[model samples]
Target: MLARLTIFVLILMLLAIGWKAWAYRKSALSALRKVEVISERFTRTDFFEEDNRRWIDSGERPDVVFMGASITSRWNPEGKLGDLAVAQRGVGGQWPSHYLLRFRSDVVDLHPRAVVFKACAITFRPGVNDKGTRRAILDLTAEAEEAGIKPVLATCVPVREDGNTVYGSDGKKLPDGINDRMLPFNDWLRTLAAERGYPVIDFYRAMADDRGFLPADLAVDDIHPNDRGYEVMTATAKPILETLLGAGRG
Candidate 1:
């Protein structure tokens, strides 16, 4: 009789665990599916590829390419980087995984000497866990090396719910400890770059205020950098880029 009772308890425990897993997966998928993206067909095929094809096919091969999500897509490459032949491919509402999907076609094909890659806050949103984000970045790093392109990884810009509703459609605040959770991932990135001898751009430190929120002057929304913010990023990046471009491919 005791054996039968033990077996029943084990069955109940397994069912409860299964239910929780299913619920977690459902919520993650829901959050991902609702991201309002600029490219209407982001998941259909290589749709966003067209956004940068012309520049890549231009007679000039760019010295560097800034590949990322919104922060990247919105940069004025020439204004920010310099007058050189630099390319950018940023799509708002995209996670690093999405960038990875097109890394070969959009980034590798351009044959830039190096790529300035930025991590997205959206990766810290619901459903997308840290392991998933880290894996995507690692994959990009490996692919860039295989293509003979330098990979310059960057941390995400500041994040806060103080200014705008970048977090949710209804303006719901992020979970109380989201940034705290993000620290581990950023730390991992820094360590990875150091171990691999890659350059890790510390954008978070450049933009975050004392309390870790983006100052009003720097961000148009809670998630995106404004003109002044972009200026700061440009200033922080140019020196490093100049060094890389100067070195070239020996």
Candidate 2:
């Protein structure tokens, strides 16, 4: 009788907590829509434009290069894979779809021995604009392979689904869930990588909870990850990326 009572009370507590979260989601999403509107002012610049000016000026390219958005920019594989020379060139708010468009100049020109591409979660809609994004990554990897550069593709990290206002209206945010569009893009990349014979880094599984959402602590806002999240990404990516770079050395 005591155990059952305890369980019942716990269940009630959980329900109360869940209800509160649901209640606040509308407000959080309302704020998000406003930010998205303002964020448009920050045009997608070169991934290595700002703080990493030294990396370009140093004229010393690493054996491996990591490129993507804020996630990759903040990734420091120090201590764990410090011996493996790697350059980080991440642009905040960049989508793979955008990265592909500038692949030749930003990545291919660098001529690193290997490139670790941290493919962020679906920023494109599959069966619509995503085909182009997929092709761009594929084309860039093919170019890398032809140039004898290893390309390591990483699975996108899971993000909070409730707050994305991309598919919503003006003042009122829509009920955009995880299965909306990004999931399909991720699926496409995974299958496409297999067919194209590229090594993949499955970062999603490491960060996602059982219900398939990024744990609240791992991410700071919605898609952007905090330091701890990057730590998890670096841990999952180091081994596979190292092996790919090692093979190039031999």
Q: What would the per-residue lDDT of candidate 2 be over residues 124-210, giving only the tens digit for each residue?
A: 322235666677677767777887788877777777655444543445544544445556666776887798777788888788878
lDDT of each: 0.76, 0.68
Instruction: Return the TM-score for each candidate structure.
Output: 0.74, 0.68
- Local error of candidate 1 at residue 219 (angstroms): 1.3
Counting clashing residue pairs in each candidate, in order, gives: 0, 0
Model 1: which ten-residue window has the lowest total lDDT? 36-45
Cα-lDDT of candidate 2 = 0.68
- Residue range with the least summed lDDT across 10 consecutive positions in model 2: 120-129
lDDT (Cα, tens digit) per residue for candidate 1, span 1-250: 9999999999999999999999999998887777635333774226446645775667456778888877887887575565556777777777788878678777788788888888767767766767778888899989999999999888778676454223454677665445665667778888999999998778888888898767888988777888988888888877777776763432
Report the error of model 1 at residue 120, Å.
2.1
Error of 1 at 57 (Å): 3.6
